[model samples]
Target: MTIRCAVIGLGMGRGHAKAYSEHKDCQLVAVADIDAARRERAAKEWNCATYTTAEELLEKAKADVVSIATPNALHRPLTLAALASGAHVLCEKPIAMTAAEGREMVAAAKTAGRRLMINLSYRFSPQSQVLKNLVDGGALGKVYAGRTVWLRRRGIPGLGGWFTDKKLSGGGPLIDLGVHRLDLALWLMGHPKSTWVMAGAWNHLGSRIGASQGKSYSVEDLAMAMIRFEDGSMLEVEAGWAANIKEGELMETRLLGTEGGLVQKNVGEGYDFQAEVFQERNGTQLDLSPHGPFPECKSAYHHFVEAIRDGKPHTATGEDGVAVQELLDAIYLSAAEGRPVAMGATTTKTGAGTG
Candidate 1:
């Protein structure tokens, strides 16, 4: 079956459109964005119909699958609307501002009998893919703990825009950058049930930078958290948008297990990443970083398209997104109250203390 795909929010949605257009099982049917320039650009570049709003696209565009790439706040409504329009949805990270909203989206997809996937792009990376295989293949036996970090130096996105606004973006790097690492860690750890979270958020840099730029900023610049899982495993997560970091950008994920340990980190503060597995044999520490080229990993977009075409389950589902969001909400809450928050804890729509 040829999956007709439409993408909303032209900024990162354009990446979705490109992937869909390139997939053999999918066709780019339409694109939507609030900005006229983005709409025009997408229409010209993808040679597809364009709409000023996602509502219009959902109403008129004949799409089998819709990619929701709008702001953090729009994910739930757009996803629900797309599902109601008989279209599967591939939404961006942090599925919604809160777990309650995330649940609604997941329920909507179930009722619509359509698939709902999240754009967890890192899962598709070659290094991450290899690490996940190792974990699944029992190389990393009894995984008990992990650490995930994504830190940036002076990398706050759009100070005055929705990104810096608490109402729109939910939170700062924790919800934006940290979500990716957190989800990656959880997935590699076999999606363990989270138990609780203790976290702290700081605005040491964002507030000052925003004031200097005459921009509105009411979110944290950095966040760190410790999460406990049901199986007695724990995860430490750290994310920062602007901070006094040595590297321009740093991303790392390390997993400790009974049999071995695995690590995936950026190379020399660059975008390129390398993965290594550690094992002890004959009382000797062995480092295994594959020497040859990695197998071509499938793109998350292509995976969504194939799932829709074949009526199969996608790797990153709405449930996975919800789990990630719940963790994020708990982290923010713990930061707000200076106390650990339990899993399945309820929070208001705007998410834990936006400030």
Candidate 2:
């Protein structure tokens, strides 16, 4: 079956259009962006119809699948509208500004009998899949604690635009970058219920940039949080848009388990990553980086299409997005109130899908 696909919000959605256009079973029918020049450029590049608004694309494009990558604020409404239009949706991460909004979108997708997959890109990585297989297969023993970090030096995106506006982007790197590693860590740890969060955020860099450049910057440049899960495990997460770190960009996730451990990190301050498993054997510490016996995993976009086509359980569903969002919301709240925030049972449901 040829799946008709449309992409909304050309910033990151441009990649979505490319992915869909490259897929054999999918046809890129249209793309939408409020920016006229960007929309035109995207249309020319993807060779698809262009729209000034997602509503127009949804009404006229008739896509079977839609990728929503606009901004943090547009996720919920755009996802709901796409589902209502009988299109499976691949929404960008953080799901929405709040977990409540994510839950609403999930329910709407359920009611409409459409699939909603959150674009948690890290989980789709080959390294992540290898780590996940080991963790899930008990090679990592009982996972207990983990640490995830994504730091970049002077990498604030769209400095004076929606990304810097808390009202539009929800939070800074915590939501933008940290959420990817957070979701990957949680997925590897078997999706534990986040019980509480203690966090702190600083806007020193953003404030300085705003003052110097006379720009509007209202979000944090760096944010850190420690989350406690119901299973007695904990995850330490940190994300920074602008920091004094030595590396240009550093993304790492380390999970400590009872019998073994795993670490996945970027290679040489770049997007290329490698993961290794740690174990103690014969009074020696053994580090193993599995290269074979496991094939390369498919892309998240391809997985979403396969899930819709085969009726399989999709990874990074709306439920998983909500779980991550709840964690983020708690982290932001805790940072703002200068106290630990306890997550509600309703907000911290286990498993994906209907949770």
CA RMSD per model (angstroms): 4.4, 1.6
- Relative to the true structure, how large is the alpha-carbon lDDT of every model? 0.88, 0.89
lDDT by residue for model 1 over 80-181, one digit each (tens)? 999999998899998988888998987888788888888889999877877887899999789999999999998988878999888998989999999999
What's the lDDT for candidate 1? 0.88
Worst 10 residues of 2 by lDDT: 346-355
TM-score of 2: 0.96
Error of 1 at 12 (Å): 0.5
Model 2 per-residue lDDT tens digits across residues 1-355: 9999999998888888999999988899999999999988987788899999999999999999999999889998899889989998999988999999999998899799888888999988777788887898998888888999999998989888899999999988999998998999988998887788999999999879877988899898999999998889999999999999899999999999998999999999999998899999899999999786677788889988877777777778888888898899889999999999998968745454521
